[model samples]
Every structure is written in C-alpha cells, then in structure tokens.
Target: TVDKYGDNSIKLGITNMLIGEYLHTIDNKKRLAVPAKLRDKIGKKAVITRGLDNCLFLYPLKEWEALAEKLSKLPVGQGDTRSFIRLMLAGASEVEMDSLGRILIPDYLKNYAELKKDIVIAGLYNRLEIWDKEKWSLYKENAGRNSEEIAEKLGELGVY
Candidate 1:
C-alpha cells in the first residue's frame, strides 16, 4: 500500500505473516501462553491440529478456514490423500485464547506433540508450530546441519 507520502507500507488489510521461535512453559493445566508477538498475528480465535514432523499446528481463524477449504477440495479417492485429510481436518480443534493470551491445549494434541513443561513455539509464516523443547532443539540442530542441501532443493523448486 502507498501512504500519503507515496511510499509503500503495510496496512491491516495486508497479510501478516508469522516468523520467529520462542521458548515458553506449559502450565499444569496444559495452558500455553503464546508469545505476545506471535499472538498478535494469530488473533484470539484459532485452530489447533496435528502437524507434520510430530508437532502441533496453530492457525489463525482465517488461515484455518482457507486451509479447510483447500483440504475439502482434495480428491478423496486416493488413500494417502484421504488419510492426510483425516489427520488434519478430523484432528483439528477450535481454541480461544483466554484473558492472559493463553490457550488450553487438549490432552490429545498435547500427547500427539509429546509436549512437556518446556515448549518451543515456532512461527512459520501462516501457522505456529508447537513443539517440545528438546525436539525443537534437535530438529533445529539437524536442520542447521543440512541447511545447504535444503537450500539447494528449495532453489531447484524456484523457492528462492
């Protein structure tokens, strides 16, 4: 968008992508306080669901709806596609952030991600990935080791 000064700037209507990693703790009640920075992008009402790589994915309401719509369009005749649809759509839960910017995670999701007291919330563009602290560390380390190879693959796909 261009402001009165004729310079480009981001406005509310533009997509607000998420990007960052934060360390946090889950309370005994399984309440996770999302980092205020990330929380601002996701808003209050969000959707939590099983994610790839043994983590939980949290999406903003609008992003979730868009994803759900896309998921609904996939061909159900393929076994893998059907399984993926079930894994994502069926396992999704609508969650609301409380007054303290905390979202109470369901036991099923908590167990799926194996979330313990210490947790890592990684903001990846449109979604937030909730992972166990140890797992994140390991994943980050492994990914860091293979970043060059990963970048090559992305380059081949024209992602860079």
Candidate 2:
C-alpha cells in the first residue's frame, strides 16, 4: 500500500523535492557520479533498489528506513503487498559513494533498466531514480501522449 499513492506523488516528488535534473554520463563500467545537489543530502552511504518504473532506484539510508517502517504494518495476506515488499527489500543494496562521489550500479540492475553510457538522475521524494538517457527521452514523450485523457480524468477528481 505504501507504493499505491497516485502517480501524482511520483510527479510531485520529482518536481518539488528533486527540483531539477542532472544529466550525467555513465562509464563503461556502469559507474556514475551522484549529482552534487543530491549527494549533499544523501551522504556517502546509500541504498539502491528496483524502481516501480523501469529505472534503478536509489535512496538514502534514512529514507529507506522510513519506507521500511511504513511497509512493516501492511497485512501479510495481500499478495500484491507481499510481492512489492519482496521486490523492494530483496533488491535493495547498500552502497557507498567513492571519493569522487561515484556509485557502482549493479550489472543486473543496469541491464534490467538498459542503463549505459548516458544517464539521468532525478529526485523522487525520498528516493531517486536513475534512467538511461535515450530511454528517458522515449518515456517522456510517451508519458505526455495521453495528457488530454489524464486531464479529463483528473478533472473528475476535482484535481484540474
């Protein structure tokens, strides 16, 4: 249920807390420099996991703890909740940024998200999502494709 908030939360996190975008290059080895703005808030130690979208998820330890705390109270009988918990917790990896503020993204995750030479790091509330640049472009274009339908739906909810 923790992840069940409307997609608006996703947009709000990215635009409000994240506030800006950092387009950076990923090395051949999948190493990336954490944006200075984000690094200042996240510190050297962080956690990485599978994101809801097709992107690698990054979180500060404190943020992960908050999420974990919220998830702990969910009913265990719900299959979807269990699956989300398993995927999020099992995929999480604790990592430390190197002296140069770089973190090594796991190969499996990189391959899962198709992250390679170029990447985009954006803030999303308590966490961050890393996206392959080209994939991000395509995703952005498609995300806007149904804007009118989305607006109409939001209007029904008194959000527009």
Candidate 3:
C-alpha cells in the first residue's frame, strides 16, 4: 500500500501506485463505483477536486491536505493564482465509498466537469483523474497534436 501517513507530511507525495484506465457510468443519482484496485490504495475516503485538464481529480485525505496547503499559499489578491484557487476549491468535494465501493458525486461537480453517465477513471501517479469519456477523447487528441512541440518546449526549459 502507498504510505498514507507519509502523504500527509509532504504537500505532494509520490507513488507509482496502481495505474490503469476504466470506464463506468455515473448513476442517475450521480453515484460511481470506484475501481477496486484504486480503492485498495486510497481506502474508503477521498477528496475530489477540479484538475487542470477540465477533469476531476481524486486524492487521498492526506494528499488533499497537502494540496490545500499549496493552494492556500496563493495570494488572494492575485489574478491567475487566485482564480485558480477559487475554481479548484469551489469544485472540491469530500466523499467516501460505501461497502460496495460506490461514491456519490455531488451534482455541482458533475455539472462542472460536464459529466453525465459514462466517465473515464485513470490512475495518475499519486492521485486519480476522472473525465467524461468524450471530453477525454478530445483531450487526448489535442495532446497528441501538441506532443512533439510540447516536448521541444520542455527541453528548452531544461526539463529533458
């Protein structure tokens, strides 16, 4: 299991964790059954928030706390960072899986991410990202188009 406690101490903990992609439907009432493999690492409780790719991000409690700290550091008077913090925080929700590993996503968040029935859940290092299927497909296409250019830019930043 990933070290939940260690995740608490650092604002961002790193873990390879279980990585896969799965598609499931959000029920009429906005309930989703988390994949079993992810459940084992995150346990029953999780914090969900907005992510950069117009998708939902799920983090363990400790990981969420770490993120909260970083967001808190953003100046309220600033433009971009403040807006980011507000949007991300406003979309955040805390949820726990039932015995069957089902989580009830609030309607507001569902609407924010334009999520309907089908959702794609993917493991991304320390956290998980959920996307509406069609939206995710579009995102992948966009990313693919920019992949080479983006890599070149990263290399210029000494990221290579």
Name the candidate that leads on TM-score.
1
Model 2 accuracy (lDDT, Cα): 0.78
- lDDT winner: 1
Q: Using TM-score, rank the candidates from best to worst.
A: 1, 3, 2
Tens-digit lDDT string for candidate 3 (67-127):
8899998778879888899777887888988888888888777877899788999888678
Q: List the residue pairs that clash in candidate 2.
A: none
Q: What is the lDDT of candidate 3?
A: 0.81
Query: Which pairs of residues collide in candidate 1?
Result: none
TM-score against native, each model: 0.90, 0.80, 0.84
Q: Candidate 2 at 97: error in angstroms?
A: 1.1
Q: Evaluate model 2: give its TM-score.
A: 0.80
Worst 10 residues of 3 by lDDT: 4-13
Superposed model 2: Cα runs more than 4 Å off? 1-16, 151-160
Please provide, for model 2 over 1-160, each residue's C-alpha lDDT reduced to its tens digit, 9 standing for 90 to 100: 1232111222233433544567999887778999876675666788888887788888877678888888888887999999998878888888888888999988878887888788988776667889999988888788799889989999999999
Instruction: Tell me which of candidates 2 and 3 scores higher on lDDT.
Output: 3
